[model samples]
Each structure stands twice: as C-alpha cells, then as structure tokens.
Target: MAEKTALISLNMGGPDRPESVAPFLRNLFSDRELIRLPGGAWLQRPFARLMARLRAPKARRAYEAIGGASPLRIWTECQTRAIGRLLGEEWRTAVIMRYWEPRAKEVLTHLRREGVKRAMVLSLYPHFTAATSGSSINDFCRHAVRFCPELDYRLIHDWFDWPPFLDALAHLVREALARFDGEQRHRVTLLFSAHALPEKLILEGDPYLDQVRTTMRGVLERLPEYRSRSRLAFQSRSGPVRWIGPSVTEALDTLVDEGVREVLVVPVSFVSDHVETLHEIDQGYRDYALRRGMTRFERVAAFNDDPGFIRAMASLVASRVPASWRDSRQNENGAPCQGTP
Candidate 1:
C-alpha cells in the first residue's frame, strides 16, 4: 500500500443555509481568538450568543442578498478537488472550516481513520493574523495533539507574496481594467481592499496589517503600470471598536472628493467568493460608490478555481512536501502541475 498524505486547507467558513447564520455567528464570536469578551473566558459563550442574536438578522439579510447562502463551500470544494488531482493519487486534499461544518476535530479524525501518514495544513488566507491563520493553526494543533499526535504534520503559514499568486492577481487586475474604455483606463483608481482587523489586535503585536501592506507592495511592484493609481483600503469592519483604516467607505469618499469617477475594487486578501466578496463588496460598496457620484464601480472576481491560482497553490504545497515524496510522485499519471516553483 502507498503512503497516504493529506493536504488540508483552512478557511473561515460561512453557513450553507439561512437557518445556520445564527449558529455560525455564535461559533465565530465564541472563539476567544476572534473576540475577547469583557467579563472573562466564562462570559465568552453568553456574550457570543447575545451578539449573534443581535447580529444574525442583519447578517441573514446580507446572505439573502446573495442567493440565500454563501458560495464558499462550493468554491472550496472545487479548489480541494483541483489541488488533490494535481497532487496525484498518493495525496488526499480536504478543506476544514474554522467556524462551521467540517471543523478541525472532524477533519483530523477523518484523516486518522483514512490512515494518512503525513498531513500538510495550508491556510486559505494568503496573509496571516492571530484572528485568522493563528486561530486556525492553534485549533488544528490542539486537536491533532489530542487525537492524532503520531501523524507527521506541517503547516504552510503564509504565502501572501508567492510569485504565481502575484502573477494571477496582476492578470486579474489587467483584465478588470480592460473592461473600461482604453482612453479611460488610466483614470481608473485601483483600490486594493483587504479585510479589516480591530486595532486591539495590532496593539497586541498582531502582524496582519504589516503583512497585508507587504502583500500590497509586492503586487504593486509586479504591476508597475498601476502603482501610482492604486491604493490600499480595509473592509468588512464590524462592531464599534476601532479597526485598521482607512475603511473602504472612507476610501470611496476620498476618491469621490478627488473627482475620481471611475474605480476598480480588488479584494486583495480573499481567494474565494464569500459573503464579504459577494454582498459586502459587490452590492454594498457598489451602491456606496454610485451614491458618491462615481460613474463606474467594478470589482475583480475572487481567484476561485482560476488555473493560475490552482497552479500557485499546487506549487506552494509541493514546495513544502518532503523531497522524497515529490521525487517519487513526479512521474504519477495526471495533468502536469503548472507554474510549479
């Protein structure tokens, strides 16, 4: 029998149905890594439930605006299969949602049962933060320690500036810019929007902001034509707490004030379509841009299963796997892995 390897991708999942919205929010808020309650650890669950109850209705409405459920799971499954096929028969890929179904514990148990000898945990988040990559890694590690300590496992923590990834983003940006009339392309303000993190996390030494900036710089360097016209802004802020800024709303306002009538929004941090990209960005931001007198507002689609993106992911995974494993599987029959590093 061949040695079975597991490639696990981590993401903050969304509810598959309307009824799951509240529970998903509860699970998210209940995570100490996500929200630090005022009272104590004991108060987390109750506060999370209260917050979820207060927020669920609004969240559900947002979800409803985009086909009544999130496309995250569907897209993630597609990515999983694509990567697995590239990795060949020796490796099995799976996606684990941080806040919903197919959680860490369940995935760990499943791999163990499948007799997987080695596992590589890959974060869907290109960038890292205590709230996201940190939390997911810690959660999986905890479960692995208790349930599958013997399994040989490793993590691909952050691949924000990977070459193939940047190439794919640059390609997408160029494609979106092409949508505008050639004469007006130079006037389009390319806004790179990343998910916002609370100021408190930065105060605690979280490197999310810095990493995001680094990613922005790297991407800009690759697309020198857009460097002067591009700007970075943060989005998806919730609660009253101060978050890294300028918020996407403020950025739009600034652009409107600057007499910029055309804008192209790029969700720099996200790889798959979810509530943030689907509704928050496409609908909410588009409306805000129009209301502010912008004549055009468009966003680049998330990479999803873009051929370049899958190749980048495969390259990242291959780079981390044992050399012996790579050498042994190099001749496996299947479509060749493209853009491999």
Candidate 2:
C-alpha cells in the first residue's frame, strides 16, 4: 500500500450479490439528493424502505437477466487499479461506491490505516449532476469529517470531453458499425442513450442534460461519418415525475417509423458495464425495439477499463490534480483541522 496518496473513484455502485438488491435499492432511494419522494425528509428513510421492498423483485429479475448481479464493482475495481498503475507507484487506489459496499467510511478507514496523507477524488460519472456526482462527493465529505477529518482531498469533476475519452467512444462506435454489412452500415442509425434525470432537476439548473448533449457533439465531431445518422435519447427513467426525453422507446419508435431498420445503441453516460448497459439496454430495450419492428439492434461495448479510457483517466489526473489538497473536514471544536486522517 502506498502511503503518499490515495486515488479514490466514486460511482453509483450496484448490488453484486443476489441478496443485496433490496438493500441496495433502499440505500439508493434514501438519498434525498437523487430522488425526492412525496414526503418530507422525516419520511425519506421509511419511504425508501417501502419503495425498495416493492421494487426489489423487478430489480432482482433485471439483475438475474444480467448474470445474477451487477458487475459494476468489478469494472470499477479494474478501472481504478489500471488508472493507479498508469499514475505510477506512489498512488494507491480504491473504489468508494455510493449506495453499496466499500462505502466512504470503509475506504477512508483503509486510507487512514495506510497512512495516506492526501487523496485524489474522482467521480465515475463524467457528467456533473447534483443527484449523481454531487451526492457521491457529499457522502464522501460527510464521512471524511468523522473517519478521516484531517485528510487532504481534491476533487476531479467532469471529464466528458477528455480527448482520450472521446477517442474511446469513437472507437466503440466504429466497432459497433463494423458489425453491419458495408451497405447496411451506411443505413445504421446511431442511437446514443443517456441515463435520464428528473425534469425538475434540470429545471432547477442541473447542467447534466447540457453536458450530455455537449458530449454527444464531441463524439459526433470525431466520427462525422455518423453525425447525420446519430440521435440522442434518455433512458432508465422511473418514478412518477417527468424525466428528460424523448426516451429510448420514443426514439426507437420514430426511427422505426422513419424506415430505419438497423440501430447501434451507445451507452453514452456510463463508463462501465452494469444493469443499465447489460440488462436495461441489452435485454430490455433490445427486445422492445425488435418487437416494435426493428430488424437489427445492438449496443456498443462498455468502456470497462478500456486502455483508451484508462489513459484518459491518467491524463485527466495529470492535468487536474492539485499539488496539494485542502482539508474539508473540521476539528472537534468546529474549526479547521490539520494533518492527514
């Protein structure tokens, strides 16, 4: 273990075991930052438990469809380790998942034990959103104040346009397109699907939608060959509130009606394989599109520690990591704290 510094990657992790699904959902719904139920904060935990109990069966089926559990932690572990190697030996790394195990308290405890004086915090979410990235950062900060109050930390935010990241997207797009015959390739509609955010959040000034669009523009610019054929749509929408759209379903409908026969789906927002990519898009939407009149439907391979993406993380760290981090934790007296955790 490296004592100099630790690189911690944050993500919306999933249940990797069969029994964890319900508890995972409960943990997720409890985060008021992400989903706000009809009740006030007082009822958030109770509501979360109820929601999780009600939805767990469906969620479990989805997990079972994707090989019995979420592979997110595996992917995140691979990514963080690869990135740490690229950043050189002085830096140790860990994955601190939101709404799952290896939580902030766990990671911070390990870092403290390793005598890590500094930490470089990076979010797996490339797009900045209060619900996703913000929640993760806040969770880490809250835990740090108690478990590692003196630890120096710096946050690395959105890197959606990091050059190597765009390169990775273009490469995946080309790979997916290659599956089609030359003539059919020309006809394939590129459907870039991003996770949906609540419309209320966007209205309240979350830049996530705009950032997603900008990322699309970046990738399309790199692969101008598919620029005209590409379409952007949102996915994984749930709850009673309106979400950003047109949804993946609506987009497919228009494509099918427009006489588009082949579609190549891209999981634009996620950096790794999880339920969203493996189950939601692969099993759910793929079946939906085929049943609704699409001859062929396919999704691009997830990044999942792809060499280019790891390089992108390295580059982002090199460019953005501060020489020293500011300690966000406070003393027992509620004043500025000093030293490492």
Candidate 3:
C-alpha cells in the first residue's frame, strides 16, 4: 500500500466510559498548563490528586445530565470523518482525545507504525488557551518526540481569525435571533459568553483573552444591525481566585435591572458542548435568568457537527501546515516535549 499522511484529530475527551473518567481527569487536572497550583510541585501534586477526588462526584453528576458522559468524543469523531471526507480519501485521519481514548502518544505511534511520516494535527479548539489547546499541543509535541521519533508534526494553533468560523458563528446567532418572538425582539439582549480564565494569566501575559476578544470583535463586525443589542460576558469560573468576568449570571441580572426581558446566550469561545456549556450555561444560568424574570433564555448552540465549522477547521489545517511536512516519507527523529523541528 502507498504511504498515507496521518491527520490526528484532537479533543479534550469525554467520560463515555465510566471506568476511565477518574484517570482521564487526573491527566486533565495534572496539566500545570490547565490548573495553576499555588504551592508549586508539592502543592500541585497533592492538590490535583485531591481535586480529582472531590470533583469526581460533581463531574459525574454533570456528565449524567448530558447522558451520563460528555459528547466531545463522539462529536470529535464525527468531525474527523467529516473533515477527512472534505480533504479527500488520500489523507488518513485519526481521532485522539487528550484525556481519553486514542491518546496523542498512541496516535503518533500508530502513524509511525503505518509508515506515515508527515502529520497534520488539528487541535479541536477554535481559540487558543494555554489551558486547553496549548496543553494538548504541548502534550502532543512532548509525546511525539519521545515515542514517534521519526514523525513530523504540523499544528494548527488558533482558527479564530478564519472567515468561515466567523461566518458560521454569525449565521448561527442570526438564526437564533430570527427565532425570537418579534414582539420581544427589542427586549432580547444577546449575551456573548466564553469560558473564563484566571485574571492572573492575563496579568502574566497570556494572549488568550485578547484572542477571544478579537474574535468577538470580528463577530460583532458582522452584526452591525444587531450591534447595539448584544454584550459580552464570561463563564465557567473555577478555583478561589478571580476569573475574567462580568460573569454570565451577573450579566443576566444586570440585564434584568436594565429592563431587558429576554436573552440569547451565545457560547462563542467553544466549538463543542461540554460540561461548561451543557451544565453551567444551559442549565445553571438558564435557571438563573428564569428566576430573575427574564421571560426567555436561549443558547446559541455550540458548533458541533456543523458543516461550516468543519470547513473552517479543514481550511485552518490546510493553511498552517508547513510545506516541508509534505516531503517527509518516514518518521523523523525528535525528542519528546520538543516542538516541531
């Protein structure tokens, strides 16, 4: 058989299999990139271990709310197949959930075994955050160099600037706006909500907030007609420290105070519906809005399984991958934790 180029589809993984959830979360919480611990290594280690235990029941509960597990894995698989089809059959695609099955390291190993040298890694995150896509790529690079010494990786960092993604988001929001009762249209306040990161990260010079804000601005440019009707807020705050806010719940209350009777919650920062969107935004904040006398609260659905989103993702992959990656016919020797050489 002729050699095939491998495209590893990456995601944060789901809890579809109950037995794997804890260990999966351990990997998740262990990433210093995700959760910053106060006490350095010792505190980081014990704290992560403790958090995994304390959060399991609650995490399990949240999973059960959305069908006893997360849908990220299934959604990612669907995206992989869709993107592969879009890219043509010449490309070999595999799905890997960083904290779940078909791990980053395993996929790299498999590609090496399959005699695939060139690799295109599409991080499932549309916007880059050190905690999410950053960690995933960091993990992939570290593992790839160590395990698949002969494989070369080309990574797609952030696709937030892509026109198609902005178009799709604009389209989705417009569609939701159209669905609102015409009589209440003026009363509908569009709330753009993204997952919150620690403010400390911003102070420390991470560009995540600026990137999402820029994407939001781009999205707003497409919304001139509705520009005056919407506002931005942050969501999914964890830990004891402050997170980027004007939180969604607080924003909802403020809208009520300002006489807005309806809200359209848009999950702009995320591409998939995970616990943050499903439990926190949909269930938690929806209830909060209802209690505060907001007559209607609707979420602009996450872009899962959307054809336009897949096109945007594929375009991102096509544009960013280095041309040299196309020439490599065998895995190239590289060390783990080291970036693409």
TM-score of each: 0.93, 0.93, 0.91
lDDT of 3 by residue, 299-324 (tens): 88888888888888777676665544
Q: Which stretches of model 3 miss by more than 4 angstroms?
A: 1-3, 324-341
Regions more than 4 Å wrong, model 2: 1-3, 324-341
Model 1 lDDT per residue over 111-216, tens place: 8888887777788888888887778878887888877777776678888888888888888888888899987898998899999998999998888888888888
Question: Taking the tens digit of each residue's C-alpha lDDT, what string does model 2 give over 1-341?
Answer: 23478888999999988899999999998899888877688789898888899999999999998899899999999999999999888888999999998899998988888788877788899888888888888888889989988787777767777778888888988888889999999899899999999999999888898889889998999888888999999998766678999999999999999999899998888999999998889889999999998999999999997898899898887665553332433423221222111
Which ranges of candidate 1 are over 4 A from the true structure?
A: 324-341
Instruction: Give the winner by lDDT: 1 or 2.
Output: 2
| Cand. 3 Cα-lDDT | 0.77
TM-score of 2: 0.93
The TM-score, computed over Cα atoms with residue i paired to residue i, of candidate 1 is 0.93
The residue-level lDDT of candidate 1 at 49 comes to 87
List pairs with backbone clashes in candidate 2.
none
* Candidates by TM-score, descending order: 1, 2, 3
